[model samples]
Target chain A: MRLSLLSDLNEERAARRAAVLVTEVGSGEQRLVREGQVGSDPLAKDLEDSLRQGKSRLAEQDGLQFFLTVQTPPVRVVVIGAVHISQALAPMAKGIDLDVTIIDPRTAFATPERFPDVPVLAEWPDTALPDVGIDPYTAVVALTHDPKIDDPALMAALRSKCFYIGALGSRKTHERRVQRLMASGFTEADLARIHAPIGLDIGAVSPAEIALSILAEIIASLRNERRRSA
Target chain B: MRSTDTDILKAAEAWRREGRGVAIATVVETWGSAPRPVGSHLVIDEDTNFLGSVSGGCVEGAVITEALDVIADGKPRMIEFGVADETAWQVGLSCGGRIKIYVERVD
Candidate 1:
């Protein structure tokens, strides 16, 4: 690997862009392919599959062997609350390599002291999320349980290609939220994307347990092949 | 804090920029219960200082030894380790897995 290529790869990662370092095994010849440049590469199909899955692998073309070092943007979790659950979720998510950011319009809750390790935005999700740059690699979780805060975040997530979107609520509460979103022109299909009653049903009662369940569900949504396509 | 892949590569580039001889060892292939996945990196400077893991510390000593030679010669080498190899007793994976690592100089 060349210094310039390594620097380019790091730049793409910092900018949250995907890239692949393709190296010929025998000759040590290498090239860095950015996300949009894959279409013109000789290993287009393999590169596309590797990027989509965020996995690296060895590929054989003709008689030569190549290693594809697939580098996807780091997975980010955007929580639209600085509540107890978010406090627990932030550190736990970071332990597993998920970059977490907390957003809450209430300055009282979104204090740096509350979330010392994670980024906390004392602004509404509509404003904060745009600067945060939600993309397919991001997971949005609304844990405020307040319509004023959670609803706007959900709306923003619904409009983006975020991989996971969940809102903390009871089933009845979700029904009301769904009706409101439907009234705002989101179809049932769009509403279906939100994992209301958020988290896997593990009978979680405590905030920490709830955070564990939510993280598990997010991992499932990320690694499951079927959900990746959906 | 654990070094992520990005940090490992960045450190490699930084080490080279600072006029240190650097090499990167990557797990290009794995079989069975490999401790680390393919594309996992272990960046080593000429002094044998390393960051990251290609086998969760299983075969790092041997990889670093080989990396020093790669950095000196500027030639890439692919090395394999497994229980099946004769060096298994010396530096093979304790997890009973086989891995192919590619060590190359940061030219």
Candidate 2:
């Protein structure tokens, strides 16, 4: 058993309370699993359940016992429009450990200089998102006011099981966007999944305040909040 | 070691050095619908105070009570779950499977 994996079982020393440990099974390719107090990785939970039923093999992963404690790791964030909001949003998002990625076909906006720690993609949404795999744990936010850059991503999020989707625009712009989406094939249910005119009714003015509101909404969504629509 | 793991271990080891009783609870085995994997744990002090979780909140009270008793006796135990135990899920372990917990007290 790898010594790192034994850390899970060892931490429970006699009277010490147990903590959950989640380790990625593979090193080369990323296969992240959240099995502890805060890891809601659906597949990880499934695998843990399967093993708990008389299959003790999971107890010996790579010759190590593998669960750990209650810390919720970072969530993945995909920003489709690399606009001013993202310039402000990425840093704040990183503060909470959400691995932020800004995608834009415009080379000028999508540069490492603009986004130091974050990964920038000078590619369009259709190509970028598939590589990212907008999983259930992924939160997608669209900040571009332009339809050509934002539309494809909104469509992709609608089709996937992403945890959160937010788009920036004025009410009128959103209304028009809705019409266009309806014409293109989105149902009321699909449209309902978006938080266009995004962010809570926080009355945010500056880009930073707006970013905070957006993050708040994402947190609320992660907690599965339901709000009555106007 | 990962910072999170190190932080938790430091807490555990400190308690042990203080001459306070400690027991490590490990999810040694799990099946069907267990919420935690085979290595999940819930550390418990002699007072039944805890630092981690194995089955959400389910089985915790029992584990705590057992933990206190283990502290008193200095005996280690392996508590099994799932096959037949409503008490474990009373607070909420409806994973519908079993878990084997190796609860060991550090001397």
Candidate 3:
């Protein structure tokens, strides 16, 4: 099949287990173009021709042209701490279609019973990192405050190249952790990647609101990076 | 559309035989009130395309743009969209619910 880069977006969305929306784009003169009819599709171009115009979003189908723009792709959330915030975080993450993976070394917290119908990894950071595969395609969040758990995971995340690596802690905790990481040989640049405190400063008072804060930060990172790249 | 890897390979093999280019798109995530669950897929041919729902037909316009770039540069790109976007309504999904879409082009 002709999976041009445009279509390749669809392909990768599938790889990442993401949902997609293909909208029909046209001017005011053309709006009745139905949804799944190929005849209504604009002259479909392979990725090469598609790249010829990043801003050209005119799809004509059944002789009627539609207009559309490519929105953001789906995101995957890998939470290293499975605490109360996590309980609220999972569904919140799922609300926006993030492929959420909750990891905790504590068996008490990481059981399927606690997080039913979700992907829970009860392994230590080191062991889980490889299995989880921290690719540029994935976002890593270290929620456990335990250095043994969060640090190893952060090290693994830094070693690999995950898009976002957020850690949960207070400003004091962040300072101490920085000292530890600095002594461990991590450079300042590496430390900069960590979104310490792990969320936006919204004065969240509950686990659920904290989850929202974290989700908001992730959203900000994704969009900000997109604008920069664009 | 509903083709498997073997199906894609078979189709790609045919295109390769004909000396044409082939591309692959994989779905990484799906959000609330979505028709297709995450992991659902669709493959596009050089001319004809395959099927399977990704978004509810809202953000594919942008995905196609990047997928083509991946095929041209022979590199991989991670693309995303949905509620998180300020202008997400431009594609009809700017509602509070969001989904992270990653597009990787495999030749």
Candidate 4:
């Protein structure tokens, strides 16, 4: 690899942006396709597929073979409460390599001792969420069950491209929450993005079981989104 | 950073900077029962040091051998292995799967 190309690749990595390194098999010629520049590339479809799936592969276009090396930012999960469910969910998310963060204003609950090594933001979601910078790869889950806290976080999530937004609540609670969101100027389409009564229906009874279901649902949503986009 | 491909690429880059010959082999495609996914990589330095896996022990030895040749010749080769083929058992792809790998020098 040329020094210039290596430096360019490093720049993309530093910026937390996605890119594809295309290497021609026969000639070893290389080019970097930054996420923003993929639209005009000749192998746009292949590059986009690699980005969406976060996988690299060899692609042949008109008999010209090229290796597409995919580089994606890490997936993130931001839990809105440092509750018992989060105690189970945080490590579970980490087990799957999702960067996890716990957010709550309650200092006693949101402690490093409770959620060791995981990022715990002791600020309100309205303040902390923006700093966290949710992106397309982020999964936002609201477990606080407190309207003041979860609602603002949900609003932030809805505005951004976070792939998954789930809230823990009963059907009745979600309906009432819906009325509040509607009154606050949220459209049906926006509200639909929230996975109310969050997590997969596995008849989960304990906090750990519920956490497992949430992670499963998040994974399913991610895979389904990729399939739909593909 | 969690991705093996990224780690392999970084190792290859470092090895190259250290003036060591380096080559990378990547799984380009796979068929039935392939253990490793496409895009999996195994990087080889001139000293035979390797990082990552292409087939979960099914084909790393073969890939490293081919990669050494690629490092010397600077030519990329696409190789295919499968369990259904006559040489499948010999090559150790006995998991009823096939994989296409592209090996190349990272120049």
Candidate 5:
């Protein structure tokens, strides 16, 4: 907990970069490993494992036990449509430790009174997604089936390394939507990333049920991706 | 507020910057019916002020008492707690489980 190390940790946090504070339990010595450096450090493999799981852990290397304190930025859930489903999804996402933001151009739907305590951005996705700053920690969800709104948002999310991208529609609707994206120059692999007919198939009949399914699917995807990389 | 690990770390840093001695207790490992996941944190200041949680409410009192000592002694230690069937009614951890928590001063 030296002043220099504190400054380093704060700087990385300000930059929204992931890092780990490694404390040698025996000696009380410490080191800050930035996300980029985790791949090359002597504890590279262990560090990567910690980062992938997004959990701090005690790692023993050569009989030396070190506490890896993980410092990851907050996970963001950006819902493109401030519709009924979003009304249910936003608060649920926040309940599970995600920062939720709902975006829609329609002021009638995207009202502060409707979504209390949630940031409702009354702007188009093209203008608002950049302002929101999508990153690997973000999960983008398109609740609106409107192609004009959801398409641009999907493109923006796909361009970045956002952890989850989901769009609300039926399987048939997704097939037609896939055709549109393909015509717009998206590859098969890129289009494959979208969780079309978004959410787990839980027989969700109500908006709240659908919202629960979507969040569950997103969490499952996040954990599965970590396992895949780990 | 959110009770996430990041919030615990931020609170620890802020408390230390405000000249309050801080100790952080982290759940290093858990086995069987543990309430909180490994890596969960409970940061306690010199005055017994704390944030976040390591085991829901199963063992905060014991952890906080150890955390106060850790902040004063500047020594780190691993402490283990387990629920036994004989004392299940006496304590809240009716479901049996064991957890190891690492307590250290945030210096």
Candidate 6:
């Protein structure tokens, strides 16, 4: 690997962009393919598949063996509340290599003492999320249970390509929330993308367990062959 | 702190920039119950200092030794280890899995 290539790869990773390193195993030849430039590559089909799956693998092209190192942007979880669930979820998510950020307008709840070692933004989601930069690789969890706080975040998530959008609430609460979002002009299909009554039905009775369930659901959404959609 | 692939790559770049010879060993293929997944990296400096793993703790010694040679030769080579190989008994993957690693020097 050339230093220039390695530096470019690190730059892509730092910028949260996807890139692939293609190495011709036999000849020691290599090339870097950025995410947007994969379409014109000779191995476009295989590159697309590998990038989508975010897995590196060996490929044979024209009797030449090549190794494709797929480098996907890190998966990020943006928790809309810094409550007990976010406290639990943040650490657990970090343990699994998921980048977590907590956003809450409530200063007391968003204090660093409550959530250590995680990025806590004591700002409103509408103001904070843009700087956080929600992308296809991000998962948004509305855990505030406050319409003022959670609603704006959900709207931001819905408008973006985030992989998972989960809201902490009951079915009835979600129904009311849906009505509010509908009145705000979100289609039924668009609202369907939000996983309400959030988390898997794991019979979670405590904040930590609920956080585990939400993390599990986020992983399921992330690892699905196709991106979860309405 | 845990050394993720990002950290490993960043270390490799930093090490090379600091005028040290560095080689990166990557798991290119695996069969059976491989300890580490494909694309796992182990970056080795000239002095045998290494971070990350291609086969958990198994086969790292051999990979690092080969990585040193790659740094000397400026050539990339693919090495394989498995339960079936006699070297596996010496290096001991013990996990009953096969893995192919590619070691390349950063020029």
Which one wins by TM-score: 4 or 6? 6
| lDDT of each residue in B14-101, candidate 2, tens digit only | 6777767877676666778877765455777786667767776678777788778777776666677674676654645676777777
What lDDT does each candidate get? 0.93, 0.68, 0.63, 0.86, 0.86, 0.94
Q: Is the docking of candidate 4 incorrect, acceptable, medium or high quality?
A: acceptable
| CAPRI level of candidate 2 | incorrect
Q: What does fnat come to for each candidate?
A: 0.78, 0.07, 0.00, 0.47, 0.25, 0.78
Q: Give i-RMS (Å) per prediction.
A: 1.3, 10.1, 12.5, 3.3, 2.6, 1.2
Q: Write the per-residue lDDT of candidate 5 for residues A1-230, one digit (tens) a residue.
A: 56457667767876779999898877878899999888778899889888877887889989999888888877889999989999998888888887899999999999999999889999999999998999888899998899999999999998999999999999999999899998989999999999988999999999999999999998998788877875
lDDT of 3 at A55: 27
Candidate 5: list runs displaced more than 4 Å. A2-14, A228-230, B31-33, B82-96
Q: Across the candidates, what are chain A's individual TM-scores?
A: 0.96, 0.71, 0.73, 0.90, 0.89, 0.94
Off by over 4 Å in 4: A2-14, A49-55, A61-63, B1-4, B7-22, B45-49, B71-74, B84-86
For candidate 5, list the clashing residue pairs, or say none: none
DockQ of 6: 0.70
Candidate 3 displacement at residue A176 in angstroms: 1.1
TM-score of 4: 0.87
Return the TM-score for candidate 5, rounded to 2 decimals: 0.88
Answer with 4 or 6, whichever has the higher lDDT: 6
Leading candidate by lDDT: 6
Better of 3 and 6 by lDDT: 6
The parts of candidate 2 lying over 4 Å away from their true place are A1-73, A225-230, B1-107
lDDT string, candidate 1, B7-84, tens digits = 788888889999999999999999999999889999999888889999878799999999999999999999999999
The model with the greatest TM-score is 1
Give per-residue lDDT, candidate 3, residue B14: 51
TM-score of chain B of 4: 0.92
